[model samples]
Target chain A: MSNKKVTGKVWKFGSDINTDLVIPNFAIYMTREEQPAHCFVANRPGWVDEVQPGDILIAGTNFGVGSGRPIGDVFVDLGVFAVVAESFNGLGLRNCVNAGLASLPCKGILDAFDEGDIAEVDWGTGEVRNLTKGTTLTGQALPPEIQSIVEEGGVMAKLKKEGFVS
Target chain B: MGMNAIEKILAKRSGQTVVKPGDVVMVDVDTAVSFDYGKPNIKKIHNPDMLVLLHDHVVPSPTLSAANGAKSLREFVAKFGIKNYFPVGRHGISHVLVAEEGLALPGNILVNGDSHTCSSGALNCLARGMGPSEMTYIICKGKTWYIVGPTTKIVLEGTLSEGVFPRDVIHYIAGQHGDFAGRNLEWYGPGLEAIGMDGRLTMATISAELSVEFSLFPYDKVLADYLDGRAKKPFEPSFPDDDAVYDQVITINLSEIEPQVVLPNKVAWNSKPISEVVGKHVDQAFIGSCANGRLSDFAIAAQVVKGKKVAEGTRFIITPGSQEVMRQAVKAGYVETLLEAGAVVTNSTCGACYGGHMGLLADGEVCITASTRNFKGRMGSAEAEIYMGSPATVAASAIAGVIADPRVALKVKELA
Candidate 1:
């Protein structure tokens, strides 16, 4: 691993923040940075300005279902350190891994920590620790193969790092 | 052990040492696509030659925000130097555009950012949908892992019964096969040559709704002839080797299947027939989406609804899957028939199906749809119930004001 620890303030959300809603269906054609500005624009107005680099977005189940349109890239582009949710849709899981964002499933973390509290995530271990709350929520870490992708900073980076392609 | 068709095809295209059923191997994809939703990563990846962009869902919709969002995407497409961008109200649904524009070629592996990208498989290519992150990864690296599936051979034999169309076959297969009941469904045998390209496209597009990894047909004279007339290039047919062994095989004699309709929440149910559903009340009826929104689908719907009005208390909405489909449909006189029948004809976007902009259902309402997905809250209200079927069935149900089977309606229209 890179020994990089992601530390971000907590941004809590309720259940089922879908892929289409995250980026919205309309903004899907824009580039990563341009699209992230509209992240959660429909639901949590002004989310872009409030979201700082090194902040985490925590949510409930079925996160990222709809079109799997790369809304996860928007979170990474907006500088969100990681995303911790109770559960995830299949496409969302793949998108997060591909984007090089640290998205882990720690359902209990939502109940333990409030918004604005700083959280530390060890992508290597899948251990998400709430710095302000001083608590750690346990969950299944990513499998070694997937962790390898994250270690190289996402799928494309990993492909290049492994000399698989240019 | 011999590999199935999907295994063999993916293995050859990927140049992988070993390709087997259920084994995931990274392979070079022939095409990678994105859209306004992918613009953020487009700049990050910085490659546009291999990518195609489409604005369908929110653009030119009932919502101004969605329309304006499409405009901003147009500006970004210009700024990024991307050549494949399809602007607002120009291109049609991404999947249909690729097929009609001849973007899909035989033996190529296609990938898109949309979940229904599998619609391109209608052209006998192995097309699948992926997320933006995956799209970026593929664009930057030119490859990704595929869980090569064992092929399941599904042969739809016999000529179609009157009013029985491709959508009926899809609904019948879904009814008989259930979602994911088979690993891979490949249409083969002499019957394959009988279905037209548009009909074939409808059947192939539903493999995603069935949750299969891949669905394909052997490129035959029919496919070649269709492409020959469109593109000025010679075509060769590609099929699995003679030694190929499918993991599972299914045979459907279309003659044995009565015009069918899949019930709510399940694709595989035949315990009841459309006759049983004739008098049931319906809140709405929708005819469009990648699964069944082709020119052929519109033509069939128009024939069913001609000189007939949708049953009172039922709302009928039609959104062509693409702009090309809409234009051809308008030229073909289907749109006017739909309007005369009291059905609303919308644009070529994923409006009602995606559940954001158009044709949303209210609470406690029941709708019959031609789009993919009947999941809760998929087309609007969570309390609403939705049943999926072919365009014929959806249109027939609109006229009957319930989930009516298309057999009688189709036969009657043929006589008319």
Candidate 2:
């Protein structure tokens, strides 16, 4: 596992944030760079414009709840460094790792901090520290293989390096 | 001391005799399915014969981009010599068609790039959805890794009374237990004998809504009979050991169940018996999806609304699960009966369910759908209301022009 740290502004959201809310089906046909603008269009319009680079998204249970459309790429395109939710759908969690997004599932993560507060994460140990609130929460660490995939910048990048795909 | 059904299937596929929760292993895939959404950038596939390609989502290509995507997949299919390809005419919702075509067999490992791929677990296989990225890896390797999670044992006792269906069964399960995120679910009991393959598939498909990794049914004579001629491959059935271990067990008496409706939006723990939501006005009655769309659904729906006309101002739409299902439905005379009842039958696709193409609900309209989901903006306008139920309930509502129970409507039809 890669030992690295990231600190970013926090964007708090509620539970059951599904794929349709992250990026609708129609936006799938759009170019990669053009897709981030439509992220969270259902609930948070203009979110793309407001979210700065290196922001961290925090949410309640069942985060990324619906269809598995690889929302991690959207998070990466939006410049979100990491996602820490109370829990995640199994399918969504795999999608996050495949897209190389650093994510942690920490219980009581919903109450750790308010939106816009700064939070720091240690990818090696799966620990999240809310700098603004001076609080820390333990999270499930990524398995060794999964961490390797994340460090390599995603499954596709690894596959490309291994000459599995073009 | 022993393995459950899912454990046995996973273990055998991974070349292990025993596996428990938290065991991670790479498994050979029996079948890997993809739809029009796949962006094929692969240099080589490990096994083309094991792959199943089809065009169902965005059927008829509502947009120019979708049409272009379909064309690309066609090229990819031909380039790889993929023989198990289903084009638009024979295309269907991948979940429904995969099981219908018998690509999934008992004791096999089936993977698809769609969330509802869990539906095939009803065939008593270790089946679940894998994302496109993982699917890409599978295409290159013909194998994928699975981290086993704790499996919950669901016991269904007794037979379901008339007017109740797998839709209602699932709704009742979700209403009481809520979502099982990061977990697995296995179904068995006396109820298995009473439910058919379609009913078991419905329960498994809707289990995706509960966010289970895999939802499966135990193999029995019921499944054996269904797979007699439909099995496209040789296979062995998997079953839990006598002393099988489970994380938890929940029992439901199917005989006690009645007509049910899942409220608009998320369905986890948000459903009620039909009596509570009666008379809720609905403009559209939809009866189709991989979950509820089948020849059986059409048969029951046609019977429920046989001689009755669709209520004035209420639109009833029926989309079969697949072209094969549509053909079987037509031969059964269900299609003609529905059309004579004033229901508009559309080509088989994932239409209206995901709100991709046909039968979109207008703003401020209310719809009662037998499809998988009822979330806001799922079928059309965010302002529209969606109530989910069985085909019988939805068909009965089409005649009543309101969200009415199927039992009452069936009684009315008999008296007529």
Put down candidate 2 lDDT per residue, B1-416, tens digits, no spaces.
99998888888889998999988877889899989954568888889989999987789888888888898899889888999999889898898998888888898888888888899989997888877788898888888777788999999899888789988999998899888888899998888788998989999999988888889898799988989899998998888899999999999999999988999878778899999999989899999989878999999999999988999989999999999999999999999999999999988888789888778888899999998888767887777889999999999999989998999878777788
* TM-score of model 2 (CA atoms): 0.97
DockQ category of candidate 2: medium
Model 2, B367: alpha-carbon shift in Å? 1.4
> Which candidate ranks first by TM-score, i.e. highest?
2
User: How close is every model to the real structure, measured as TM-score?
Assistant: 0.76, 0.97
DockQ of all models, two decimals each: 0.17, 0.65
Query: By lDDT, who's the top model here?
Result: 2
Chain B TM, per prediction = 0.92, 0.97
Candidate 1 segments exceeding 4 Å error: A1-66, A69-147, A150-166, B1-3, B44-47, B61-68, B229-237, B266-272, B414-416
Residue A88 C-alpha lDDT in model 1: 59
Query: Can you tell me the CAPRI class of model 1?
Result: incorrect
Share of native interface contacts recovered by each model: 0.26, 0.52
Q: lDDT per residue, candidate 1, B1-416, as tens digits?
A: 56655666688777874587646566777667765443433334425565677776665645565566666666656766667777766767788777776777777777887777767666777787787557766766667776555567887678887767777787777666655422566779767778988888878877666656667877778787777756423333347767778777888787776666666533434324455556567899998887778888889899899999989999999988788888889999999999999999987877788775778888889998888766555677656777876788889899999888887787787788
lDDT of each: 0.72, 0.87
lDDT of 1 at B116: 76
